[model samples]
Target chain A: MKSVPNRILLLLSLLGFASALTIVFYPLFKKPIHTSVASSMRLKIPRIGIDAAVESVGTSPDGAMDVPQNLDDVAWFNLGPRPGAVGSAVIDGHSGWSHGIPAVFDNLYTIQKGDTILVQDQNGITTTFVVRDVKTYDPKANASAVFTSSDGKTHLNLITCTGPWSAIQKTHVSRLVVFSDMEK
Target chain B: MVIVTMVMTMLASFASPLIASAATTPSLGSAATYGILSSTYTNTTAGTTINGDVGFTTGPALLPGGTHNNYGSGSPYATAGSDQANALSNINNQACTFTFAPGAIDLATDTTHGTIGVYTPGVYCTSGPGAASIGTAGIILSGIGTYIFKIDGALTSVANSAVTLQGASACDVFWAPTQATTLGADSTFVGTNIDASGITLESNVGWKGQALAFGGTVTTVVDDTITVPSCTSQTPIPGGSGTAGTISGGCLWTGPNPCSSYGPQPQKIQIAPVAIAAVPVPVATLPNTGLPPDTKNNTSSVIIISSLSALLLITYIVRGRKIS
Candidate 1:
């Protein structure tokens, strides 16, 4: 009788334990789709950011900003893909600043060929673009191609402060502008 | 209290994976945002066209050097208020041409709804196999101050002739297998593993920007890995975040190139699964309903039986010894 009871108890306990364990570990099995969605939300790669407050406008006939004679306190946009009322979209940023990481334009100083840029509208629609060339010129006799859109194509212009940093007033001697066309 | 706080901290740390999922979803939206150049001055005024011509963004882009060429308004290549002059306009009807024939160019910023053109150190209305086959060139006579020129149309600019910039820099339309939706001097692009064929770069040719492909976005998939950004696997990054983003090769800037970081930009992650330790998941606890708490008798019974079994075995062994 004792053997019988012991045998029954052992069998019952083993079944009960297995059930208990399965219930506890059920979460280990998950939906792959759900996992993928979760993974995407995570930042797998790092990216860059510019100012979100600059006004949006298209290219203008004479929409280019006047280069300050005193390069000392230049005021302009620090992001590309400017959205003005008309003309090619313009976005400007600072190449470097006296303090801090400066602004979005700080990275403009390192641009090279074959780069792509994306500009978005207030509604979150991105306008893709690519790099063609770099230009460095004296502010005195600045050219028009830097700001103008030849072939009347829609493009994005990114401008920033360039040249050696000034110690006294603290500003770049020359301003840099990058012109890019809208990517298809 | 300290123990309780520590426990709580651990629990929260364990649950953070569930908390970081509140960001926005990346999706490739529609592809239909093109701006108008002008009602007139169109090369082939047939269907919509996008011209990617200008390769350089420099001060004094260009000037009209010949007869009736008061294009820069006067001051040569770049003069007072001539910053909008372009290198090439709708010339030769080369659809999608971003170049000019080295001459006087007009910056129609003031001529609202008119054809506007600009210049640069490279070929104006510069054409090539890939660039010329698409988008039409135009000089719309639009009202000035840059009214149109949006980047939504099917337009692009590739290098036909090489352009040189500052002594330390070279310029070319190094067409990567991938193209960007936008371009800029502040941005530079580097093609990884993806062989950039048929595209040549000028000596010391340097640029900064995100690498973009004209064909929407490209992505490849293998047995266990999905590479690049294919139409099915990758979605378009949302727009207007205004965050200076790195599109791997994404940029749209002009001279004195606005972008600063040119060394080695971010690299593409050959996405593959990695083995990781599995952790237990949190579960909901059931409420304990008040009831008569009965002590479990099985354990106690087991203990007693075990003791009895041992005693019986010892007795048997002693009996056997005595018999022998």
Candidate 2:
């Protein structure tokens, strides 16, 4: 009877050890979720632990897509279709350090394909989006595809500055874009 | 009184046909091949497709997707620029058959053609310091002749507005604006717009003629399609198959020559010059979304996950030791 109780404890400890190992390496084998959202007021990337506010923005004086003034927030291009609309809706965020604080998209480059992005609106309804592609572009590259979509499906694209910094230009040399599609 | 009424009706009918005379068509010359001709052409989105040639003199013309003969300050480009200047001058010098004073002018409703907005071949002028606008109701070009619109100020069209052609050719339509010309989003415009101040096209604007901006930039946003009208003898007159008569110059038409009848000229309205509001030009660059480099790394999640894993492992080891 004593041996039987000891065996049960041994099996339980072994099971616990296996569970801990799996938990540690779970991200490596995890499959990505494919989904998308509508009429966004907030952007949530559960994988990177980002839950940031979204602000509406237009073209800047220099005719570029404007970014949010706040480091913690993302700016949605209001001139284009709204998030979850038929066309491609663009949102831009700041990356790098802002006054010793991490900006909203500091870890944007770490986002992987198939990640789930959630957009929540004022009505408390949440829309989900799945990552389709991640691309890098030159600073002077024609980024029309980021703002326009002809497939007649709702799309959301997130943009952030990546690559090497240009001290003279006061901006990044390249841009990182995350293209997502609204879940059907 | 009955005789007087019959005579008045006869006079009105006769006067209607003589309201507008055919305006002279200015030759585009080498500029005819270009859908977009400017000193600098700037396009933001990759969706813009120019069906004809695109020429620029001073350019970093960032056009990514389009099937066209792209020219930069050489050969036909320089010739096209000169031809555009000449065409602009010719159109500007043409006498106005009807002029509308600036404030609150809609081409569809405010013109002499009244609510019908059907304009015959003539030179129409909007004497401004004020702007002229085409509302959503739009306007129709009715006959086969040169139709020139001379706006001393800015010209803008509302979204979804269409410049419809009835029995006219798109090639014969010219818009000469002294200031900037803005075609609103998704608006379908049919004309050869010659502007000294610049041309800005909003998203999805479908233009069937040329955007010739002399000494100015031509800026296009997302998904604008500009096709240079190929004016050939076989150009079909939409509703002019049966009753349509051929003019002496081989131009086919459906209606009577408006200038053939005798009538008094229409009164022209002159408005005081108002100062035009300057439109902001779009610069060709992407947004600046990067911050300065930081030494601090954002690895809070990684730290947390690793710590949790270590704790789980420690717990399992301690429990196993106790069990043993």
Candidate 2 C-alpha lDDT tens digits along B63-146: 324445433433356667898899888887778888877554678777454446788888888764557788899889887677
| Candidate 1 docking classification | incorrect
List model 1 lDDT by residue over B1-324, tens digit each: 999999999998776433322111111121101111111111111111111111112111111011111111111111211211111111111132233223222222222222333222121232221222111231221111111121112222222211122221111121222222222122222211111111222222222211222112221111111112112212222221211112232222222111111221223333222332211111111111111112111344445555555555555555556759
Per model, the share of native interface contacts recovered reads 0.00, 0.31
lDDT of 1 by residue, A1-184 (tens): 3344444545554555554445434435532211110000001001343323232112233434433121121222211223321124444433433211133355565676667665543234555667676676454444445544424356665566566655553444566666666665
As for model 2, its CA RMSD to the true structure in angstroms is 17.3
The i-RMS of every model, in angstroms, reads 28.9, 13.9
Expressed as tens digits, the lDDT of each residue in A34-89 for candidate 2 is 11112126899999988887765667677788877677888777555557655677
TM-score, structure 2 vs. true: 0.45
Worst 10 residues of 2 chain A by lDDT: A31-40
